[model samples]
Target: MSKNILIVDDSMSLRQVVSIALTGAGYNVIEAGDGNEALTKLNGDKIHLIVSDVNMPGMDGITFVSHVKQDANYKFTPIIMLTTESQQEMIQKGKELGVKAWLVKPFKPEQMLDAVSKLILP
Candidate 1:
C-alpha cells in the first residue's frame, strides 16, 4: 500500500501544491490548516509521514512536532518542515523535535519529493 502523508499548512495553495506532488508520486495525502487541526486529524490513522509549516496561528510546527514525538502512536513517524522561515533557531527547534528533514519555502517539488523519498518510513 502507498504511504499516507499528512501536510499541515495554513495556506491552501501550498497544500495543493504539495498534495499534487505526493499524489502524483503514488502517495496518499491528508491536509490540515494548522497544528491544532492536524492533531485532531491524527485520530488512529496509519499515517507514515508529516509535512508541516512553522509559523502558524496556534501550535506552530515545532510545538506540534514535540507533541507528536511524545505521543505513543505517532512518535516514530517521520516529519518534514516545509516553511518560509529559514531562521537557524527555527531549524534547530525542528531538529530537536526529531523532524527528519527541513525544506524552506518556495521549494522545488522535485527536491521536496527527494527528501520525502529518503526520509519516509518503510
Candidate 2:
C-alpha cells in the first residue's frame, strides 16, 4: 500500500507542487491549507509523514507539531518542516518537538522526496 503523507501549507500552489511530486513518487498525498486544517486531517489515519510550513494562518507549524507529538497515535510520525524561516531558534524548537527534518523554502522537489524516503520506511 502507498504511504499517506499530509502536507500542510497556506499556499495552494506550494501544496499542489508538493502533492504532485509526492504522488508521482508513488505516495498518497493529503493536503491542508494550514495547521488547523492539518490537525483535522490527522483523525487517527495512517499518516506516515507530515510536511509542514512554519508561517501559516491559524495554528503555526511548531504549535501543530507539539499537538501531534502529544497525541499517542502520531507521536512518532516523522515530520519535515518546509518553510522560508531559516532561523536557528525556530529550527531548534522544531527539533526539540521531534521534527525529523528541516528543509528551507525554494527547495527542490527531489530534495523533499529524498527526505520523505528516508523517514517513511516501506
Candidate 3:
C-alpha cells in the first residue's frame, strides 16, 4: 500500500503543486486548508508525513506541530514546515515542536520531495 501524506496550507495553488509531486512519486496525498482541517483529516488515517505552512489563518504551523506531537496517534509522524517565514526564532520553535524539517516558500518541488523522502515513515 502507498504511504499517506498530509499537505496543509491555505494556498490552493501550493497544495496542488505538492499533491501533484507526491502523487506522481507514488504516495497518496491528503490536503487540508489549515491546521484544524489537517487535524480533522488525521483521525483514523495512518499518515506517513506532514507538509505544513508556518503562517496560516486558523492555527499556525508551530502550534499545529505542537498539537501533533502531543497526540499519541501522530506524535511520531514527521512534519516539514513549508512556509515563507525565515526567522530563526520560528524555526527553533518548530524544531522544539517536533517538526523534522523546515522548507521556506518559493521552494522547488524537488527539494520538498527530497525532504519528504528523507523523513517519510516506512
Candidate 4:
C-alpha cells in the first residue's frame, strides 16, 4: 500500500508543489493549510510521515510537533520541517521534539523525496 504523507504549510503553492512531488513518487498525499488544519487531518489515519513549515498562520511548527509527539497514535511518526527559518535555535528545538529532518525553503523536490524515502516508515 502507498504510504500516507501529511504536508502542512501556509502557502497553497508550496503545498501543491510538494503534493505533486510526493504523489508522483507513489505515495498518497494529504494537505493542510496550517498547523490547526493539519491536526484535523490526523483523524486516526495512518500517516507515515509529516512535512511541515515552521512559520504558519495559526500554530507554528514547533508547537504542532510537540502536540503530535504527545499523541499516542502519531507519536512515532517521522516529521520533516520544510521552512525558510534556518535559525539554529529553531532547528535545535525541532530536533528535541523528534523531528527527523530539516529541509530549508527553496529546496529541490528531489532533496525532499530523498528525505521522505529515508524517513518514511516501512
Worst 10 residues of 1 by lDDT: 89-98
Candidate 2 wrong stretches, greater than 4 Å: none
User: Which residue pairs clash within candidate 3?
Assistant: none
- Cα deviation of 20, candidate 4, in Å: 1.3
C-alpha root-mean-square deviation, each candidate:
0.9, 0.6, 0.9, 0.7
Predicted candidate 3 versus true structure: per-residue lDDT over 5-112, tens digit per residue? 999999999999999888998999999999898889989779999999988999877778888998999999999999999999988988877789999888987898
Q: What would the per-residue lDDT of candidate 1 be over residues 1-122, giving only the tens digit for each residue? A: 99999999999999999999999999999999999999999999899999999989888888889889989999999999999999898788788878889999899989988999998867
Off by over 4 Å in 4: none
State residue 39's C-alpha deviation in candidate 2, in Å: 1.0
Instruction: State the displacement of the C-alpha of residue 120, model 2, in Å, after optimal TM-score superposition.
Output: 0.4
> How close is every model to the real structure, measured as TM-score?
0.96, 0.98, 0.96, 0.97
| Of 1 and 2, the candidate ranking higher by TM-score | 2
Name the runs in model 1 displaced over 4 angstroms. Answer: none
lDDT of 2: 0.94
Q: Give per-residue lDDT, candidate 2, residue 86.
A: 94
Model 1 clashing residue pairs (backbone): none
- The global Cα lDDT (0 to 1) of model 4 is 0.94
The CA lDDT of each predicted structure is 0.92, 0.94, 0.90, 0.94
